[model samples]
Target: MTVAEGVRPEVDARSLSDADVLAIRADFPILADEGLVYLDTGATSQKPRAVLDAERQYLEHENAAVHRGAHRLAAEATERFEDARATVAGFIGADEDEVCWTGNATGALNTIAYAIGNASAGRGGREADRFRLGPGDEIVTTELEHHANLIPWQELAARTGATLRFVPIDDSGALRMAEAARIIGPATRIVAFSHVSNVLGGVLPVDELVALARDAGALTVLDACQSVPHLPFDVRALGVDFAAFSGHKMLGPTGIGALYGRRELLNALPPFLHGGSMITTVTMERAEYLPAPQRFEAGTQPVAQAVGLAAAVRYLEGIGMARVAAHEAQLGARLAKGIAAIDGVRLLGPAPGEPRIGLASFVVEGVHAHDVGQFLDDRGIAVRVGHHCTQPLHRRLGITASTRASAGVYTTRQEIDLLLDGVRDAVGFFGVRA
Candidate 1:
């Protein structure tokens, strides 16, 4: 199933073979190392050769400041940068003008949060009033959010006189929709949440939540760092006013991410970072700004990283996102079942046989997460340990930390089996009664 250039393969998700999976693994150089079982893709993915080459070629041949100079190199660089934007926009079902580049997803999220805060302080004139928040207003999120998603809203609430609220999660780590209905009401001005839980691997009901927010006359913000890589996502279809995702988590470079916003809203929002490349007319006193994306992207951008991210999108497109989702779902079931069979292991997120992405987090009885991680590492299996940047969720689950194993397109069933084997060994090594 070798993908043709500029052509997406028509692949049946359920029909993918071990040979097909193994063939795709060759495109990632890190997978070639037999001693390493890289299963921490929920944190960040390994870059494929296509993505690496795209970035390297841009840096070596077309390195120049985009949208600034009148030289040939500058023209080429600008063209490539805008082309990358278009690629990312098309990938997420958004217009090119709606996508804004930032340092990372956290940066993108902060850009939106701070811009709204500025609006509350009377920035961007009357058009920005839609984003304004005060004492009577409320912001809604979830307890399952990563720190990046949680902290920004907390600060936003503090800056404004608005109150911050969260939807509680059930014992099974699923969002309590009934509680959400009660929390999100007339006073709610903004609804922010993750499309997928990074620690628990639980998929959220975006459509239902978006509808609730829409009915409440609230703006919706989606944290798509986990979903964008593993799922078939369309921001427009999801009906979120703003969505943020990181390039590094999706097989591209670090220090680059994108925010997808409604063009009208973006144009109305105040600029976050100010300096060069975002001005329309500058004078000694005040500077006029550009439109939507250019308005938000104030400084020099991540040129090579954007190119690599575009290449990564093309790679995923070649594989077909539906197939990618299906592949991960299949692996998720195996992982869930394997973990459930272990005596002392308590799997988080949805119960066994329930739908989830290809990841699992667990706590082993009488053994700390660090011990579990070390045992796995000794057996040449790489897994993520600690709170996974969701300390609040861990606290809710009545644990301080957890061990997580996340799969990527390059992951194999053998690697998952090894993880299970290592966990069983760790339980016995710790002399747990169970």
Candidate 2:
């Protein structure tokens, strides 16, 4: 795990070696194909056999309704389900009661927004008053946000008569902190933003934003969808009131995700959905709900998926997160340098030699992003195109869409070279000149 003599300063001192990466690739069955070069981990990761086996094994042997039946199967299912919650909670450095399972990151974020909206509408009793928002109240976010992070707040603002403000990013897609101080004032009720730019692949200044929110007495919500999988993440360390992340992006199942909140805050917040499993006592006239995490989870839980996600975290823990971050850092540097050297290619987010994760987005002059994506696809190289769920960021960058190449733990340096070569070939194939 020692740092090489000439390694980039942005890269962590401890990184996985070439042999480590090659060995890791064997865990993913999809990577065994000779022609396939996957660089779309930003969208969804390729699951290892362990994750797949965990889910399948659960479905085969322990399939039962969690928190419902009185049989042995139900007991087993509930035990595994809650154990998965504990695993996820430990992974994020949160109390077990603090983590709430949701459909995905989008659902997790919407749960918060909707809960606040419900609180504003006089739900959850007097304890929920703290979450209430009105006309004068402001919810601050950033210009560079995925639709999942941006739209829910927009809906919350619209429903509650609260104003939504955003901190603008500079021309290079960096957050403008000077402007942020002005925007996040006493009237700001919630300060929601991404921990890392999904489009830019650059980490955001979370500590500074949290400080601003703390000074303003505002609740901080983090979109940890991009950061949690790539970086060594801890909700307690980040000092965010709440955070949301998806399992699919972290090498687990698609339908499950988590929302981490402080225990008191979650208890105070109103529930987003009402159903059988989340309640304590129910009469014909009135019904009471459980506290915190259980209050948030309703109906059928994702039992097998939870087991799978737990396995995914365990797999990641086996390979230290610091080493994972360092590996991605090296890949990011290579992407930046190679893309920068290419004629007519504009690298988004951090420039070459700057700090970023193992992902890069760019625009090629005289070529549509879709064309570039298709060109890469033709060469059996997978990448992402379009605004990448960040239309506002794309508009700010003065483009409709761009191409993105991302990596995961199973990705190798050789695959990164393949993508670079494909992009270069695409520029020539599209008749774009220096």
Candidate 3:
């Protein structure tokens, strides 16, 4: 296992009070609200002034269709769009050609899943054979998957006659690797899972899981929506077949996200979305598709959103991912520890101090998660309270729903404390405790 260097040995995600954090928070104008404890970054992060300004500048000055026209506005817009691609590509450790655009992480994931199904049906051009699915093939994921990762596979399995299987979750709400080893054997054609669990807060043991899937000759897909913005992600180093993540969840504008596939693999995979920009030529008889990323990015694309996302990438780079991750780790550990101390509270992930991201999902005994969230909301403490789109994980964890608090660069310890305090009051107010 490759443990990242410079990970502070002691600090939890909330422990960073350094000048660097102060400066980092200052760049995000929304952080000026000292009273509002925003702990919903896992759902969507708050935007920084730089990203907002970049989007505004593009709309006010260089708005035009990209990759289609030869006019002055098109030239400038094309330059900015491609430059934005370069910026995002560098941020995630991928070549520009390996990254494809989508509306959101859900869209990126569904695009890949649907494309694979299309390929299975002999619809994905020359690359169709590589991803062909049938009754003999098994597609594997985990019980911890968010519905975005889970449902698409389910639908694809139904479409292609492939058997859909999943790695089981233990009592602690984690993918049981032992069960995974048994499920992803020779018949397995693809193994997809989250890099970080949205409900569990556990970082999946990727290298070990990847090794098993690779040995079985299966392609590997990763959902990086929960990991990339919160931590440093290197797609090449991670050695996955494909990956997907959203822009808005990381403080970028909504309606844009990215999908990354290895260059060779992408070249061999059929284009998922088809339209004007995705094709080289078309006739009444047949259409020849473009290659790799361009083949995947259909239509005019989300130019301003891409620009905003690039600015968000630059903003994150300026603060440094290592620092951002360190800060989150500290907060996560502290949040886990503090929550554990309260009676009748059950955490829905790895235990305290286990490797985790800056996200946590837990339930207050007898208090419906929605009620807990509403109680917290009364104090201006915004948090996501529900099944968290992982009904399968909740079912495995023996619960129906959970309240989650996911942190980000702008999140603070004092703010987390407010959440903790709110949870205590919520338990009493909801009569979850006697």
Candidate 4:
């Protein structure tokens, strides 16, 4: 369905009214299930009918291996595939040649790490010298990074004999900017960080980090998994050298994600996965690969998934990202305030009035996170439990896990309220008192 089909055309798309949001919710078939309050959008979003239909249409009518065949179907498939690339590029404010499709955000991050490792091993030759790392060189990231961002760097450091460092976070899960300044110095070869904390929900200062990386002559890699789908993001505006985000978290299918890099950087970096569909020419002894994206995309591409992601991007654009940010801000504030008022509940990330995305992960004293999650699920309120793939962040908080209630565009105030009520009941039921 068109974005304007169910929603009121008279209303400005920049401001999504309650009626407009409800109308938008009608596009998701899963939400039609009665009493189902899905508050775990941070984990993965419910797919819109538009995204589902887009993938289905491609699979049923236009399925063919992209850039490999000479027939009409193959030609049409290749056109659709490249068009999807263009659409994704536009969404992230990147050039068409800068975006590369991957299996997921983890794979995307690994792609950069492995490419750097290859450079250190002298795979890309003199042009890839920019990516080389050595004993004295440091790869700087933050303690708040998801494992997907952190572990890859760790592996890279090990493989290249480089040191891996991190900007520390305080007890409240906020990044220590002063420490970050001190830690990220001339030795840093790369600065990788999350755009938003999946655990804490606070937005990181991207421009500030970019400036630090620039001064250090280091490349900046952004984990935009949490920010791109919800915020009005521009990779060029943020000035990051590379970024990675997933389709599943942004209202599209799983097994599809993207890595965006500056065209020059991507072209200079060596290919991570080597196989068919990415090479320009092959000799019995040696092979030469294509440019940035093609060199990275080896084997069969996820044609249907890419089309679905493009559809998801268009759907978000229809509602306007500014409006999405505003709506989620309101929900974040409500969640923070409500959780703060509940005895024995400790809210993570920003304070009640502080800026954050529309997600709250909190610890309820004397209750295990899994117990809380079960209670919420019993009441038809779904939330994320455990470390949210941020074990280091959780360890810093002195907790093993926390229950996270995250919102989406389709989420209503009532849904947040229901989540809050569920948490309250969970506390009471578990006999947890402050």
**Residue 34 displacement (Å), model 4:** 1.3
Q: Which stretches of candidate 1 lie over 4 Å from their true place?
A: 1-7
Candidate 2 regions off by >4 Å? 1-13
Give lDDT tens digits, candidate 2, residues 1-434.
Answer: 21211223244548788887877777888999988999999999999888998999999999999988899999999999999999999989999999999999999999999999999999989999999999999999999999999999999999999999999999999999999999999999999999989989999999999999999999999999988898899998999999999999998999999999999999999899998789999999988999989999998888899999998887777776787888999999999999999998999999888999999999999789999999999999999999999999999999999999999877888989999999898888888987
lDDT by residue (tens digit), candidate 4, 1-434: 56634443234435467886788788899999878999999999999999999999999999999999999999999998899999989988998999999999999999999999999999998899999999999999999999999999999999999999999998878889999899999999999999999988999989889999999999999999999888888988899999999999999899999999999999999999999989999999999999989999999999999999998887887777788888988888999999999999999999999999999999999889999999999999999999989998898889999999999989999889999998898888999979
What TM-score does each of the candidates earn? 0.98, 0.97, 0.95, 0.98
Residue 241 accuracy (lDDT) in model 3: 85
Model 4 worst lDDT run, 10 consecutive residues: 4-13
Cα-based lDDT at residue 162, candidate 2: 97
Stretches of candidate 3 off by over 4 Å are 1-15
| RMSD in angstroms between candidate 4 and the native structure over all alpha carbons | 1.5
Which window of ten consecutive residues has the lowest lDDT sum in model 3? Answer: 1-10
Arrange candidates, best TM-score first: 1, 4, 2, 3
Clashes of each: 0, 0, 10, 0
Model 3 scores a TM of 0.95
What overall lDDT goes with each candidate model? 0.91, 0.92, 0.85, 0.92
CA displacement after TM-score superposition, residue 297 of candidate 3 (Å): 1.3
Model 4 per-residue lDDT at 291? 95
